[model samples]
Target: MNSIPASRRWMYDRMYTGRRGLKESFVHGVEKFITIACQQQSYVNEGKLRCPCAKCQSTKIDGVHTVRLHLFKYGFMSNYYIWTDHGEEMANVDNNLIGASSIGINATECETSNSMHDMVCDALRQHGAFDILENSNVEEPPNEEAQRFYNLLSEANCPLYEGSSESKLSMCVRLLACKSNWNVPDECVDFITKMLLDVTPVNRCLPKNYYDAKRLVSKLGLSARRIDCCVQGCMLFYDNDYGKNDGALLQCKFCHMPRYHDRNTGSSTKKLVPVKTMFYLPIIPRLQRLFASVQTAGHMCWHYQNRSTSGVLRHPSDGEAWKHFDRVHPDFAADPRNVRLGLCSDGFNPYIQSTTPPYSCWPVIVTPYNLPPEMCMTKPFMFLTCLIPGPRNPKAAIDVYLEPLIDDLKKLWIGVQTYDISKKQNFMMKATLMWTINDFPAYGMLSGWGTQGGITDKRRLYGVGKVTSPLTDVDTLINVSSGRATEESEKIIQLEEQVRKSREEARQSREQNKRLQCQFQSLFNVVLPLLPSDTQHILQQQVDQQSHDNHDDQQPPPTGHYGDDY
Candidate 1:
């Protein structure tokens, strides 16, 4: 290690007690360092130089402006007195630099580095996991899936901006969560992001819009697949056979309804739009992701690990249904990692207060019961598997929408190779659909039963005995007919009485108004003849204008008035 220079001792103690009580000398040092670093042409690569901040420690390369900002915020790394990484040279300096080993990771550096990344590395290290760190043993390389997950982790660890504590992954997640919680439209979200970009000082890493945000976050591997469905919900335009071209069919096989809305017959350049679409979020990848995370992997076995044996029914594991399932499927229950999932679905109006035409949208949610009761029921644990599109409820036709989910469920039951981060091993993990939750109408639709007091058993039938109408008896029929006639007669009598009173009051008011107008006209005529010629002219004009106004008021309104539209 090179000895620290006497003149540059301020680099070690970047802060000092000044008139302001405590002031940062780090900003001045960062400015001087950046000026010197930028002068080394040989060390600069593509207009960028190595950042020697505490967090980066010469590992990250950035432009001069970003390097200065990072150095000012996090200060220099420990024992970096020589600045060798930034083209600085010293006589007889050791090539094996100080603080290069994993053991030498100091508190300041760790605090400045990405906290989430540190937690992930620590958890993996505890399980004897390898391949995450570049220096880890490469004798046994990670499998394709694990390698992909590590790549995603690296992308997620990237900071949102230079010297920012928040990561790109976390920022994107928060933005998406806000969008969902407030039911904000995609266009609105895009507009808000543009506004955010304008207000922010450093926006290079910030997403430009909603699409950019989604694209960046998609690296996490959780995404929905939009499959075209029949407008009538007869069947999905999905093909299991790779060799078959049935999925490309323009019309439904069962209903023969056109796949797209009517378009110009001669226009081949137009896009083929699906009349209906269902978004299916694959369950296998999500289930694998649960095992991939150290925090959630151990929680997946919480039900088995913390089973209540005191005869208290605190969790679903204590229920008879769970016990029966375990007894019947001993092989599946042998491993605590095997997932038990419960499905739930319901329809809701997306536009609750809108005056636009109403429509129902059904979302199918799946929850893993392997987690503890409290965690399994929470919103974060509840995964939305499918979004069934609807202008109307799917009803019994919901089975068509659930086809993709059912196929995934079947595959999960068989088992898939998954890597468990907590166990640091790969195993064939299995899952099963334990039950379904829904309201009475949804239950009837899912089970193919009538919601109106319908029983499943054929032996027992409701309202099976012979029934007769109340009007079957002649006396009852006569009495009902007489009562209806009497009610109608009373209504008519009351209506006529109201009409007579209104007409009589109107006639009396008209007569009174006519008498008053005649008396006023007679008095005006008598006064008009006694007036001088100039005065008479003005008085005549006033009389004529009053008569015209009265004539207009007495006349009926035009037959085709604008108010008739209502």
Candidate 2:
């Protein structure tokens, strides 16, 4: 860490107006800016600033430029725990904050440059770094995990000083993620490699070629495993007989289609149809990944417990269709924890060229309806369950690609044993395929409902679609309109009559009782003084008994008549 003069820091602060786009200006005045920022803090004085370095702060080295060095090394968001009341050293604090690297990159050299770009650019040219910037139009904001990973690779061998293979591989992954295409040409890969080397801290070591980059990504489990399929698209080389065995048949057993044409054959390799490729990214693992995180796992049960039931049908759960299915299959609906899924399959032309030969690819997607209604159909919540590759649309034959997925769905339906992260327990995780959502064409193909004049389950269909014609029977219509009542209506009328009668009787009883009370009061007031003490006591007893008998005789309202109906 170099000690910067106060005058330089003041000048840098004055020159840099805190504009985001003034990187060039800031870079030229970087030292001054750091000095000014540090001086403004309460601890900085004429020739000294507070030292946050583990070694210097331990000995209270006020003269050390630990604060500036830390900033330059770790970027802006570093040293979160440096400003504590106890004045703890960097080594003493736990560094679990995201993007905080286990190892630090030395940025003291960069302090000489006015801007970060200038420093990085100088290193790029010296190291013969490729220009990967050409392919990247959007620069993603710095991510903590990515930063940590990048720094880890850089620190392995003083990466900025001497580039390492690990650092190059990290750069490769970043390029691939940003690139539109999954597969790129050799020349393109070379260009990306050069660009990464230039920008990466250690600009020397990078992948020799595209193959090397791919090999590294595969080893890291970041690439999907590809399974070869029969040229006729019979089945994926995934099952035990096809994929697992050493002497697995290359030809489709059912269709007798060769997986690959023999090179020795008189036919040109270009004339030979290539083996179909199927990328089967297992859904169970993907789903399990969702449950492994507390944030998403909590949301998985939103539909069952938290979805609105306003009956306006803003979401699928609020509609009659979802409720009908649930009502019909009470056993499946018994557990709110069980996931309900909707299968959506559609075919689209990938090339999007009218002049080219017609070809379409069908992607089978599964969406968990268990997420909150708002997020249920969202891209993040939906999983690409299967891909039916094609030079032609699979149409009805799409079921062939669905076999593996179906088997998995069956296992999930039967309740596979899974660890629930939210509950922190091992439990049977059940999922049900509730419905398939698709366009009219896809619905017919996927659901065996023929598109041409086909009535699906005519009896049920008629029941669902039944519409009454205009009534010719005026008398019946008039009866419906008039007060002519059915058994239910007559019963309701009878109940109403009973309620009225009850009310009338109660009202009459109350009036009679009040009149009797008035008469009794008049008699008691006049007779009380005339009676002897013994006689008065006897008379009071008689009056109390009479009142009790009258109250009992009034009768409680008929218990079962209107009360039960109304």
Best by TM-score: 1
Residues 231-313 of candidate 2 have per-residue lDDT tens digits of 66666656642234512566777788887756775655565444787665566656654554333455566556545655565
RMSD of 2: 25.3
Error of 2 at 513 (Å): 92
Query: What are the per-residue Cα lDDT tens digits for candidate 1 across 1-566?
Result: 13334446667676554633223555666677777777765345368876777776554567778888777667786656655455444223432322122224344543533244444333222222233222322333445786686777666656667756555665666677668778889999898889988998887777888988788777767788999999999988887522435688899888799888877779877887788899999988889877875446767877776678899999888876677667777998899999888878899998877787889999999999987664677665689998999899998788878877777776777788887754556788888776668886886666554446212221012211111211111111111112344455455445545756766776677677779989999998888889899999998898889988976665533433222232
Residue 444 lDDT, candidate 1, scale 0-100: 63
Residue pairs with backbone atoms closer than 3 Å in model 1 (clashes): none
TM-score of each: 0.56, 0.48
State the C-alpha lDDT per candidate.
0.66, 0.51
Least well predicted 10-residue stretch by lDDT in candidate 1 = 471-480
Off by over 4 Å in 2: 1-173, 181-186, 198-225, 233-237, 240-247, 265-274, 320-337, 454-566
Instruction: Name the top lDDT candidate.
Output: 1
